[model samples]
Target: MAIEVNGKTIETDEEGYLINLAEWNEDIAKILAAEDELSITDNHWEVIKFLRDYYDEYQIAPAVRVLTKAIGKKLGPEKGNSKYLYELFPYGPAKQACRYAGLPKPTGCV
Candidate 1:
């Protein structure tokens, strides 16, 4: 499938994750978040940016447990737990946030 962001048509997979990670930008994230009914906030950007950095370092998407711990270590404990993450991405933090961050569907995510 495809989504229009900033007048550009971006491609996505069946589940809505971006097909071309290079095509990703903040505007793409905004479009994806809007489609998911989420209003992007600074808090959301924190996790998304973190995910992008983590991916650049590891070339892989971390699962929920790893994501939470990594986030705790990097972003502060207050923003690390499942509750806070869930509040931002009700669908599943690792899955949804990675999608918004323009990463692939995390391994082991159903």
Candidate 2:
């Protein structure tokens, strides 16, 4: 599938994750979020940015448990738990957030 962004067509997978990670930018992210019916807020950006950084360093999308632990360590405990993350990405934090961040589906996610 493909999405039109600023007059350019960007590809995505059947599940809606970006086909080319390098094609991602803030505008693309906003479109992806809107597709998911989510309005990007500062808090959403925080998690999205964090996921991008993690993917950059690790070359992989983290699973939910690992995401929670890593987020706790870096972003603090209050924002690290499943409850908080779920509030931010109710579909599944790692999966949905990575999608917004233009990464592949996280391993172990159904």
Candidate 3:
């Protein structure tokens, strides 16, 4: 599938995740959150941005433990802890956030 943002086309997998992870951005994230029927908020944006940067640097989705740790280090304990992350993405932060970020399901998520 393909998602269009500002007249530019971006490709996605059968499941709707972006095929070229590099194509992701805040606008893409917004489009994806809309697809999932979610209203983007600061909290949601926080995770999405973090996940994108994490992917860019690590080349892999951070598992829950790594996610929490990285988030804690960067955003402080309030936003970084499991309770907060779970509240934002009950399906698991890496999985659910990746879905909204237009990225594929992380390896080892299941």
Candidate 4:
């Protein structure tokens, strides 16, 4: 599949994750967020950027549990909980946020 951003076509997998991680940019993120009818907020960007950094270090997208723990460690307890994450990415924090961040889907997500 493909999405048009800034008059450029970006390819995606069947599940909608970006085909090329190197091609990721803020505009692509906005397009992904729009697919879910969400508007990126500062809170959402925090999680997205956090996930990207986490992936950069680990070379893997985290599942929800790991994501929560890692986020707690990095971003503090207030923003680490599932409640805060779910409020931001109602469709499943790890999956949705990773998608927006242009990381592959988390393991064991099904």
lDDT value, residue 26 of candidate 2: 94
Better of 1 and 3 by lDDT: 1
- Tens digits of per-residue lDDT for model 4 on 21-104? 999999999999998899999999999999999899999999999999989998899999999999999999999999999999
> Model 1 scores what on Cα lDDT?
0.94
Q: Which ten residues in a row have the lowest lDDT in candidate 3?
A: 31-40
Q: For residues 1-110, could you state the per-residue lDDT of candidate 3 as single tens digits?
A: 89899899998887777898777778888887777777788988888888888887888878888889999999999988999998887768888798777667888876
What's each prediction's TM-score? 0.97, 0.97, 0.81, 0.97
By lDDT, the better pick of 1 and 4 is 4
| lDDT to native, each model | 0.94, 0.94, 0.83, 0.95
Let me know the TM-score candidate 1 reaches against the reference structure. 0.97
Where does candidate 1 stray beyond 4 Å? none
Model 4 residue pairs with clashes: none
| Model 3: pairs clashing at backbone N, Cα or C within 3 Å | none
| Candidate 1 residue-wise lDDT, 11-64, digit = tens | 999999999899999999998999888899999999999999999999999999
- The local lDDT score (0 to 100) that residue 37 gets in candidate 3 is 76
Best by lDDT: 4
Model 4: ten consecutive residues of lowest lDDT: 66-75
Q: Estimate the overall C-alpha local distance difference test score of candidate 2.
A: 0.94
